[model samples]
Target: MASPVSQKLEEKLVCSICLELFRVPVTLPCGHNFCKHCISDHWHKQEQAPAGAEKGYTCPECRRAFERYPELEKNVTLCSVVELARDGEARVSGTERCEVAHGELCPQHGRLLELYCEDERQCICCVCSIRQCQRHRRVLFEEERSKKQALLKESLEKAQEESERIKQAMQELEERTRNIKDSSEGLRSVILSKFTLLRKALEDCQWRTVARMEQEQAAALGHVGENWSLLKDRLDILGQHRERAQRLLACPDHRAFLQEFRLLPSPESPEALLPVEFDVASVVEPIAEILTNVSRLLLEDLPGSVAPKAPEPVGQDHRNLTFNPETANKYLELSKGNRKATHSPGTVCGRQEQGPRFEPWQVLCTQGFGHGHHYWEVKVSSHSVILGVTYHSLPRERQQGHKFNIGLDGGSWGLQVREDCYLAWHRGQAEKIQEPLYKNLGVSLDYGKGLLSFYGLGERTRFIHSFHSVFTEPLYPVFWLCEGRAVMLCQRD
Candidate 1:
C-alpha cells in the first residue's frame, strides 16, 4: 500500500470534469485546467445562449469571462504529473477514495476537508471553514455521508421498480403480438371453409346437370331406333313383292304373269317420316340457371354468414374506425392510416377546404352510425383534448367563437379531459366530474336509445359519463386537440 503522502498527491492530479485522474489535461485562457471535452462542452453551452445577448465565454470553475473563446492547448506539465501520479499510486490500499481529490486539502489553509458547509454545498477543512464559512451551516464528513447513503438506497429501490415495470410492458407486448397471429390464422381457416362449401355446392349442381343431359340423350336415341324399325319392315314387304313379279315374268306366259300379279296382295304405301329434332338449348337451360344461382349465393350470402358479430356489452361495441382527413384542421396532421392525429408545426395551407371538418381544433371520423349500438376506443396522448360524438352537420366553417363547436352546441356532445379533472360538455353546458380519464378511452354510442357513454380503459374500465338525447341525425366520432397534442383511434377486433 502507498503512504498517505502519495494518496494526497494523486488527489491533486485528478481532473474536476470527470472527477478522476486526468488524461490529456488542457488549460483554459482563464488559467484553469480541465479535460479537453469538458471545457469544449462548457464553451458550446455558452455559444447556445439567447441571441442578441452578450457573446462571451466563461470559465467553468471561476466564472471568469473572455471576449472570445481561445484555442485550447494541452497542459504538458499537468498531463505529465497526472500520468506519474496514476503510475505511482498503482499499489493504493483501497477503493474508498475521495471524490474530489482537490478536497483532500484546502487551497487557502492546506488542511483536510473534514467538514461540509451546507449553505454553500461544498466541503471545507476546519481551518478554512473558520475563515470563509464562518456564518454557514455545517455538518461533519461522516454525518453527510450517512445522509447521502440513505438517499442512494432509496434511488436504487425506485430504479428497480421502474425496471420491473419495463419488463412487464415487454411481456404484454409479446403476448399481444402472439394473439394477433392467432387471430389471423383463425380468420384464414374460416375463409377457406367458406370457399370449400361454395365449391361443394357448385360440384353438386354440375353432377345434376350431367345426369339430366344423359337422360335426354338416351330418349332421343330411342326415338331414332323406333323409326328405323318401322322403315325396315316396309322395305322388306316391298322386296318380296318385286321378287314375286320377277318369278311370274320368267314363266314365258302372259296368263301366268297376270294371274300372279292379280293374286299378290296390294302393297300399302309407307307414311312420310317425321324429322327428329334435338333441343340442346332446352336441355342445358337448367345448367345455366345452376351457375347463376351458385354465383349469387357465394357473393351475397357467404359474407354475412361467416362475418363476426359485435358484442352488445357496455364497453364491447368495438368498431374499426379512422379519422377523416377532409374534416381535419389545417394545423392537425392525420397519419396515412388515418388512425392517429397530431398537430403539425407548419403554417402552409395544402388541404382542400371541404366536407364536415371541425374548424376549432377538431376532426370527425370517416364513418357515422345512424342506428344500433356502436363502440370504439381512442388512445390519447395529450391532456387538452375533447372526445365525443357529433352530427355530420356540426359546422365545417369557423365561426366567431361559436358555441356550436364540439361539446358546445346542440349538434355535439363531448368529454373534455385535462391533467387534473374531467368535464362533460353539451350545447354550451359543462358538468364537472371527479374521475380521471386515462390515456385510453372507450366510447360507446347506442344511437337507437340515444345513450352515449365514455369509459377509461387502462388497468380497469371506469365509466366517466353518459348523455341522453332525442333522436335526430347520424352521430360521428369526433375529437378536439390543442396544439402540439395528439390522439389515436384504437383498432380492435
Candidate 2:
C-alpha cells in the first residue's frame, strides 16, 4: 500500500465538483483550484439558470462572489505536483490503488466512479466512460440519483395508499360474513316450527331442507374466505416495500442508495376487488318444489340474506344534478337550466368574483349525497374533463402549479378523462387506467356500503372502476372542464 502522506496529497488534487483528480488544474480569483473544464462548465450552467442577476461567477467551493467572470490561469505548479503524486504512488504500490480501491472503486480501471452509465445501469469511472461506454447514455451520478430519488418517493406513497385500501376491504369482508350466518340461522328456526305442527312424514322433509340451507351457507362463506386471503397477501407485500423504501430514503450515502434502489423489485399491480354477493333466493326456492304450496308461503316471508332479492334498479336512485353557479370559475359557463357546463376562455362566465368561487377552472354540484344509493349520468363533449366527488372542505381558492385541484388532497377523489386513458387521482397520487374514450359516463354511489363506481354508458352500462373507502361526511360531485370542453347532465324522467 502507498503511504498515507501520498494519499492525502492525491485527495488535495481532487476537484470538488467532479470528485475526481484534477485534469488541467486552474486557479480562481477566490484562491480555489479546480479542473479548467469543470470551472467553465459550472459558469455556463449558472448563466443559463433562470432569473439570474447581472453577474454570478461564484466559486462553488468557497461561495465567493465575483462581479464578472474571471480569467482561469493554468496552475502549472499544481499540475506537475499531481502528476508526481500519481507516479510516486504507482511505484510505491505496484498496480494497486491505495485509498480509492477501498470503496466504490472500479475493479478493472482502479479509479473512483464519478459518472453513471444509463445504458449499463451502473456507476462508471473516467476511463470506462471513454473506452467501453463512450457512445452510451452517460450522465453525472448526482443527476441520475435525483431522478431515482423522485421515483422512490412516488413508489413509497403508492404502497401506503394500497395498504389502506386493503385494510378497509378486509374489514368489509368480515362484516358481510357475520350477516350471512345470522340470516341463515333465523330461516332454520321458521322451518322447524312449521314442521312441529305437521305429521312425522313432514318432519323428515324438514331435516333435508335444513341440511340444504346449511350447505349453501358454507359455500358462500368459502368464497369470502378466498377473497380475504388474497387481500392479506397484497397487504403483506405493501408493508414490506414501505419498510424498505423508508430505509432507502434515509440512507446518507448516495452510492449505496442508488445501488439498492436498482435491485429493489417493483410492487405488483393491484388486482380488482371482486363483488361479494351471495344468491340466497336461489338456494331457498328449490324447497318449494319438494313440499306442498305451504312451503312456498313460508319462503316468501324470509328476511335479509335468507330471501330471494330482486335485481337492484339502477334508475330508481337516479339523481337530478345541477351546477352551483356561485362556485363556478370565471371561464366556465352554465346552461339556462343549470344542467350544462362549458369552458371557454374568451367568453367570461362572470367577471366579478361571487362568494367562494373556484380559482381553478372547476365547479361543484348543487346537491350533496350523504347516505344512500345514488346514480347520475353526464355527457362530455370530449376528453380533458375531470368528474369526481369532493367534500365541502375542499379549498375554493387557487391551487399552485395545477390547472384544477379536484384530487390533490384526502377530501376528494377524481377520475380525469384523458384522450388515451383515465387517471384515478386521490391524495395527490394518480393511478392510470387505460380505457377507450366514452362520451356518456355514469357515476354510482352506495353510501352505506362505502362504494363509488364509474361506468361507461353504451349498449349496457360498462363497469369501468370503483373506489371503496369509509367516507365520514357528505360528498358533493365536482367537475373541471378544460378549454373547449362541455359537460351536460343527462335528463332522465
Candidate 3:
C-alpha cells in the first residue's frame, strides 16, 4: 500500500493537463505546469483554430489566457521531484504486504513483521520499510525461508548420500580384512606342514649319520682289543722263558743253562699290529658337504622361498570374455561362440541401422572392468593386430588417415603388433619397441592400482609394455585386426 505522504507527493507531481506524471515538465505564464510536448501541441492546435473559433493560447491545467505566445521554460525543480517520486514508486510498488511467522514484530515500528529485509537480514514492518529500509532490498519472509529450506534439503541429501557411501566402503574394507586373515591362516598351515616334513627328513638323516659313526667306533675298538690280547700272550711267554733261564743258572751247570737257553728259544718278535682308529673326518666330511650346501641354499634362496613373494606387476585374474558382436565393424566376423574376431575385408554383415558398431576395423569385448585385477589372453593369427583396453567414450568413427582409432586419444591405450616390432600408442603418440611378434598375447588390467599391462604369452608370460594412469571409466577390452588376421579370446575356466 502507498503511504499517504507518497500519495500526496505523487498527486503534486502529476501533470493535471495530461493526467499522468509529467515528462519534461514545463511551466507556462499562467503559473501552471504541463509536459512540454503537451503544452506545445495544445498551442499548435489553437494556432490552427477555425476562423469562427477563438484564436488564443491558454493553460490546459489553469484555463488562464496569455496575451502573447508564452515561451515555455522547463520546470527543473518539479521535473527532478517527479522523477524522484516515480523512481521511488517503481521500487515501492513491487509488493504490497507480507506476513511474518511466529507473531514477530518489527522492533523499530512495534508493528507486525510483515517483510524480510534481505540487505539487513532481518524482519521489518511496512512502517520501518518506508522509513529506514526504503533503499534496502526486501522480500516476503516465506520466500527467503523457502530458499533456505531448499538449500538445506539439498545439503542434507548430499550428506546422507555421502554417509551411505562411506558405510558401504567401510563394510567392504571389513570384508576384505576378514578374507586377508583367513588367507594368512591357510598359508600358515601350508608352510607349517612343509616345514614339519622337512624337519622329519633332517632328523632321519641325523640318526643315520650317528649310527654310521657308532659302527666305525665299534670296529676300531675291536681291532684295539685284538692287538692288546696278542701283546699280553707274548709277554707271558717271555716271562716263562726268563724263569727257565734262571733255574738253569742256579743249577750251577753251564751245560744245563745252555740246554735251557736252547730249549727256551728266543721269543718270536711281537707280531706287527696294524694301527686302527675311527676315521671321524671320513664320517663327518659327507655331513659337512651337506651342511655347506644347506648354508648356500639358505643364503641364496631361503629368504625368497620362506616367505610370500612381492606383488606381481601384472596379474592373472583370467577372465573369460567374448567379442561384443554389437560393437563389431561390418568387416569383422565373430566366430567360435563369439570368442574370435577376424577381419575379413569386403565382408559386410547385416547390421542394424544407426547401431553402436565401430566404423573402424575394431571390435570390443563383452566384459568391462571398473576395479580390481582383471586379465585376459588372446591368440592372434598373425602380426598387424592391435590389442588394448578402451573407455566406452572411444569414438566409433575411423580415425583420419588410419584404419583403426584405438589408442588415438586419452580414452584408450594400445599395443600394435608389427612385423618387425611392437608399437605402444596413446594420446596421438607412438613408441616403437623392437621385439618379437607374440602370437599369443595377454592383457592385465589392475584398475584399482591404475595399471594396464600387456604380455607376450609364450612358455612364460613376458611383460611387453604397461600403461599407468588414473582411470575414471570402466575399461573394455578392444582390438583391431588387419585384413586376413584374426584374434581369439582365450578362455580359462
Candidate 4:
C-alpha cells in the first residue's frame, strides 16, 4: 500500500551497523549519514591513529580530516531527507547536478552515466567505454554499488530472523521468571508458619520450667524456716531453766534446786537428731515410674501399631548412680574372702572371681533426659580392690569411665567415681585412669586413715561436709567387673 519511494527511503534510513531505524542520526562532513551512537563509537576507536601518524584522525567515508568536536556535531541533512521520504514528504532539492555526456542515457543501462570523481571531470557514454576503466586496478563505481546492494539485502534478512528469535526467547524468560516468583512466595509462607509454631513451643517450655523451679524453692524455704523457729523455742526454754538455777544457787538452796533440776532429762544430742528425708519419692517416683512404664510399652510393642501408648515419662529420670567410699573397703575384703571371724558379713553373689579380688561393674539401666546431659557423683572410701564402670549396652570395645588397681605398691588410698554417682575406693595410689567426667559436674577426692572418698556432683560436692547413709548391698542389681575392675567394701545402711 506504500509508494516505492517511501519504501526505499525506509530501507536507506536503517543504520548499516545495527540494521535498524537510525537513532540520533548524524552525518560526516563528506555527507554520509549514520546513527549518532554508531559513528561516535567508530570514531572513538580510530581516534588513536596508527603508529608514526599524525594525532588527528580522518573520516572513514570521506577521508577528510576535521576537528573532533565539530565533526561529531555535523548536521545530518541526508538523514532528515531520508526520514521525510519514509513518511512520504521528502523533496529532492539542492543536490549536486548529475554530470552525463550530452545528457545521454547509458546504452547498457537506461539510467544516466554520472561521473563520480571530484576533479578531472571525465564523462563517457556506456557505448563508448574507456579501456582504462575496463582494466583499471581500482574498483569501478558500478561494481562497488552492486556489491553493496547484495550485502545489504543479506544483512536485512539475517537481522529479521534474529529479531524474531529474540522475541520468542524473551517470552519464555518472562514465563519462567513468573513461576520462580510464585515458588518463592509459597516457600516463604511455609517457613513463616513453622517459625510461629516453634516460637510458641519455646515459650511454653520456658514458663513450665520457671513455674516448677519456683514451687520447689518456696517449699524448701518454708521447711527451713519452720526448723529455725522450732530451734529458737527450745533455746528459749533452756535459757529460762538456767536463770532459775542461778537464782536458787544465790539463795543458798542451790543443792536442793540442783536435785530438782537433775530430775529433768538432759537435752537431746544434736548428733542423734535424725536428718529429715523429704522422700522426694512421692513426687519424683511417680514420674520415674510412669516413664519406665512408657519405655516398657514402647519397647514391647512392634514398630507399627494402633492401640494404647506407652508410659513415656520414665525416660525423663536422669538420676545417676553414686558410690559410697566406706562401702568400697568392704567390697574389696569380700572379693578377697578376708572377712574377720568375729562377725559374718552378707554373702557376695554374682560371677566368680578369676583374678586377685578385682572385677568390672555393669550398667543396670540408662535413663535419658531429652533436653540436655545429666550428671552423678560417687565417692570411694578404701581401695583394696579394683573398680570400674561401663555401659554394657554399648559395644564391648567402647567401654568408658575410670578403673584402678588399688594398693598394688602400698600408695596412699584413693577413691574413684563413675558417671553416675557410683563410688569405689582403694587402699593405695592406683594407676591413673582417665575417666569421662559428667557434662555438668566436677570431681573431688579426699583421703584419710584407711578411708578414701570421691565426689562428682559439680562444684557443690566441694561444700558437702556430711552425707546421709542409705541402703547398700552386693553387686546383685548392678554388673560384675570381671575383665575391667571392682572394689571391696562394707555394706552400709
Candidate 5:
C-alpha cells in the first residue's frame, strides 16, 4: 500500500551501513547515506586494524576507497523526508497520532500540536502557530519539553534549600523552648524552698511570742493575788474591831467595855491598801514590741544578716552590689565603703561627666545584667526615696519635668515608698502596693521571664509588686533620693 513517492523517500532515508531507517542521517562526500553512529562504528573497526592494513577505508555502499574516514554532514533534505515517511507509515497502520482527543485538533489543518508558543507558554498545532503566534517566539514540542525539565529541576532545588532552612529554624525554636521550660522548673523549686523556710521562721516566731505573752500573764496574775490576800487580812482585822466596839456599846456593863478596850491593844491601824498594776497596756506593749522585732528581723534583714544560710541570690552566686561612683549624681555622697548614698545638701564643684550620671539625684549599680536572675537589697531610711532598675541607655541628663525620674516614667521601673503607701512605677504608670510599710526592700529580676519583683523585708518577705515585660536591654539597679535621704546596699554575707 506504499505510494511510489513514499517508497523512494524511504530508500533515501535508509542508512546503507546499518540497512535501517536513518537515525541522525549523515551524508558523506560520495553522496552515500549512513547513520552517523553506524558510520563511526564502522570506521572505528577500520582504525583498530594493523597500521599498514588501515588504508582500505571506503564508503560501505559504493566500496569507494578513501584516504581516511570521510567527514560527514547531516543530510537536511533526508531528515525532512524521514519525518514525513514516519508519519505516513503511522497513518497507514492506523495508529493514534494525536495524544489528546481528536476534537481538540487544529480545526483548519487537522493536525496535532507539534509546536509551543514561547511568548504565551502554551502548546499549539503548526497551523495555530502560523495564524495566532506568528509574531511570538516559538519552539518545537520536544525542545520546549527539554527547557521545561531544566526549569523544573532548578525550582525543585530551590524548594529543597528553603525546606532545609525552615527545618533548621524549627529545631532552633524547639531548643530555646526546652531551655525556657527547664529554667522555669529550676527557678520554681528554688522559690518554693525559700518560701518554705520563710514560713517555718514565721511559725517559730509566732510560737515564741505566744509563749512569752502567756508567761507574762501568769506572773502578773500571781502578783495581783498576793496583793488581794494582804487586803483581805486588813479587812478581817477591821471587822473584829467593829464587832468588839458594838458589843461593848450594847453591853449593860460599862466595866466590860472598858476592860475589852484596854485589852484590845488598840485595834491595829488598818494597813493602807496598795493598787495592783495588771493593766492590759503593759501586757500588750511588750508583746507587740517582741512581734515587731521578730518580723523586722525575718523580713527586712533575714536574707542579708544570715550569711550562707540566707537565700542564695536567684540564679547566681551572692554578689555585693553598690552604687557606681562614676554614675552617681552630684548631690549624692557615697559612704560606708561606697555602699551608702546620702543626699548631700549641695553639689560638688567641677563634677565631670564620667560616662552617664543621674542629674536629679540618682545613681546606678556597679554591675549591669543582660541575662539570668539577680536579687539585691536596699536599706532606706524614710519614705522619701525611690529604689529601682533602669537600662544603661536611660537618659542621664536632667529633664525639665519629672518624666525621666525613676519610678515616674519610661526606661526604668521603680518602687517609691511614700508616707501613705508603696508605689510601683513604670512608663508613667503607678500601681500601689497595699502591703505594710517596710524599711528594707529586696528587688529581684528574672531577665529570662521579664519579671521584676519587689518585696518588703521583715521577719518574712512580703510581696510588694512586680513588673513584667520582655526587656530589650541590659538592666542596672538605680536609686533616687532627695536631700536628707540615705540608702545603703546590704553587703552580701
Candidate 6:
C-alpha cells in the first residue's frame, strides 16, 4: 500500500549482516555494510579478524565465513533512498546558508563549499567565493587545512615543553622546602641546648647566694640570742638583790640591815673594789687598742680582700676612744705624699739618697697595745738638734690632725708659738727627767711657747714649754733621741 519511494527506503533499512531490514545493523568481516559501527566495533573489541580471510571472524546471525573478499558493493538503491531521506530531514531542520557578502552566487560554479577569503570576514562556499572574494586574498579549504596542521604541531610541542618545565620546577621547590625544614629543626635543637645550660647556671648561682645569706643570718641570730641570755641573767641577779633589800627594810629593827646595805657598794661605783690602775686601763685601753687594730686590719685588707668580717659590737673602751692617731696619720700621709710614696713608700724611700735624710718611726707599733691608746716619750738635750718624724711607709699631711717631733723640716719645733701645746717622749725619758727643759733650759729661748708632757709608769707625768703653740697639722711620731742621754718611755693609763 505504500509508494515506491517509501518501499525502497524500507528495504534500505535492512541489516547487511543478517540480509534483512536493518535492526541494529551490524558490520560483517568481509568489508560489508551493517548498522552504524556496531558489528565492526564488536569485532575490534573482541580482537577478531575480518570475515573474508581463512581465519576471519564468523557472522553472529548466519555464521558465514569467506576465503576471499565477498561481493560487498555499497547498496546503491539503499544509499539513494538514504540520501533522499537525509535531504528531506535537512529541509525540515532548516539548512544553513553561506554567510558570503551580498548573497552573491558564483558565476563559474553553482555548488557551495565552506571556504574563506582573507578580507571577507566570513565563511564562503566555493561558488560564493568567485563573486565575493574578488578583492580579497582567497584561502582554499585544502590550504587552510595544511596551515592548521602545522600550527597544531607547533602548539603540541610547546605544550609538551611547558609541562616538562612545570614538573621540574615542582620537584626543585619540594627539595628546597625539605632543606628549610631540616635547618629549622637543627636550629631549634641548638637553642634548646643553650637555654638548658643557661637555666642550670642561673639555678646554681641562685642557690649559692641563698646559702651564703642563710649562713650569715644564722650567725647573727646566734649572737643576738647569746646577748639576750646574758641580759636576762643580769636582770635576775638585780631582782634577787632588790628582794633581799626589801625584806631587810620591812622590819622595824632594820638598823643593822641598813648598815650592811650601806657597806655594800652602789652599782654606779662598781670599780670601787677593783684596782684603780686596772679600772683606768680597762676603760681606756679598749678604745685605743680597738682603733689601732681596726686600722691595721683595714690596711692589710687593701684592694678588697676576702669578704669583710662581721662588724663586732663596739666595747665600752672603744666608745670612749677619740681619734685613732695611726689611722689619722696614714690617711693624712697618703693624701699629701707624692704618687710614688702613696703606692709603695718603702720601695721608693729605700732607693732615695741617704735614705731620705730623716729617720722612720714606728708611729703605729702594734706591740704595746693590741687595741688601746699607748704613749711614748722623748727627751731634749741641746735643743739645736733637729728632731722630726718621717713616715718611711707613707707621707703625712695637716688635714689628719697629727703632730710629730719639734725640729726643722716642717716639724713642730720650728719657732711657732701658741697655748694648749704639749710634747710627747719615749718611756726611757719619763723616769730620768724630773723637771722639763721649759722650766730650766734657755738655749733658743725663742722656741718656748709650746708645753711638753711625758708618758711613763702608767701615766702622763711631766709638762714642758716648747717654741710652738697648739698643734694643727698632722705629724709623724719619730723623735731624735740625744746620743746616750735621751730616753724613750711607753705607757697607757
lDDT for 196 (candidate 2): 64
Predicted candidate 5 versus true structure: per-residue lDDT over 238-261, tens digit per residue: 888888778777878778877876
Q: lDDT for each of the candidates?
A: 0.74, 0.80, 0.79, 0.41, 0.73, 0.39
- TM-score result, candidate 6: 0.32
Give the Cα-based TM-score of candidate 5 against the true structure: 0.41
Model 5 lDDT, residue 422, Cα: 86
Per-model TM-score on C-alpha atoms: 0.36, 0.37, 0.37, 0.30, 0.41, 0.32
Once fitted onto the true fold, the runs of candidate 6 whose alpha carbons sit more than 4 angstroms away are 1-111, 118-123, 248-493
Q: Give the per-residue lDDT digits (tens) of candidate 2, residues 355-378.
A: 798988999999999998888988
Which ranking of candidates, highest lDDT first?
2, 3, 1, 5, 4, 6
True-vs-predicted CA distance for residue 32, candidate 2, Å: 99
Q: For candidate 6, lDDT tens digit of each residue in 55-118?
A: 6545656767555433333343344344344442232121222222223332234233345675
- What's the lDDT of the predicted structure labeled candidate 3? 0.79
Better of 1 and 6 by TM-score: 1
Best by lDDT: 2
* lDDT, candidate 3, at 361: 88
lDDT of 3 by residue, 268-333 (tens): 888998588876657765665465346445544577644212233344667899888889999898
Cα displacement (Å) at residue 381, model 3: 0.4
Clashing pairs in 2: none
Report the CA-based lDDT of candidate 4 relative to the real structure.
0.41
User: Please, what's the RMSD in Å of model 5?
Assistant: 21.3
- State model 1's lDDT: 0.74
**Candidate 4 stretches greater than 4 Å from native:** 1-154, 248-251, 254-493
Order of candidate numbers by TM-score, starting with the best? 5, 2, 3, 1, 6, 4
Q: Can you tell me which runs of candidate 3 are displaced by over 4 Å?
A: 1-316
